[model samples]
Target: MLLETSIGAVIRYKSPVSSKEPEFLILKNRRGSWGFPQGHKEHGESELETLKREVREETGIQFLEIMSFIGTIRYSYMKLNGIRSHKEVKFYFATTPIRDIVISYEHASYRWVSFLSGLNFLAHRQLKSILIKGHRTGLY
Candidate 1:
């Protein structure tokens, strides 16, 4: 068994004037599955640095105000080469005012959705649990 670690964020956006609930950013991958922006940590990069870079690369939203680390999610899958691997994803709660996005080739589309909508959009139970933990942080 192999272990892999990645960093990601649940990016929240709220209009300063609208007084509405904060919307979360979700990316639809080429496979048509939705998830947050995340990637493997690069050499010599800290967790936060990796998370920031992943967010910018995927969403083109650079001004991330990282609120706090919510929690970690773990899952297992088999790689293309038939190797079983366990992955751990550390998720942070972040906020950004920018709404415009230039999605990278990795994703087919993107959306800014309400908390409940995000929960509905995500298929993995672990991801939904993480989102709920982030929402419970009282920052939004």
Candidate 2:
């Protein structure tokens, strides 16, 4: 099986209204699956570099404050060519003050949702776990 690695961010923004919970940004891809901004790593690029680039490219949010490395999620899936591949995704806990999103062509839409809403938007258990971990860290 082939192995692939990806980098992504669990980007959150605290609402200006103190009573509201911090919201996370999730993107809906052309395929209609909702997920954090992520992409395969490129040669010669550091993990942080890939994270920032992918987030910027996907969301057009330029002022990203990457707080820390959250954790990794691993899984396997069958490729289009019928080959099985294992993949690992590294997620960072990041923050952004800007909420005006200009989603890239790769995505169909985007939403800034509360933590619980994020879990509802994401179907993958791994992704939900990542969000829970990030919330527990309280780093942002």
How well is each residue in 1-140 modelled by candidate 2, as lDDT tens digits?
Answer: 89999999999875578677788999999998899999989999999999989998999989898889999999999999999999999999988888999999999999999888998999899999999998888754
TM per prediction: 0.96, 0.93
**Number of the top TM-score candidate:** 1
The positional error of residue 96 in candidate 2, measured at the CA in angstroms, is 0.8
User: lDDT per model, in order?
Assistant: 0.91, 0.91
Q: Which residues of candidate 1, in runs, are more than 4 Å off?
A: none
lDDT by residue (tens digit), candidate 1, 1-140: 99999999999885786778779999999989999999999999999999989999998988999989899999999999999999999999888899998999999999999989999999889999999887687756
Error of 1 at 94 (Å): 0.5
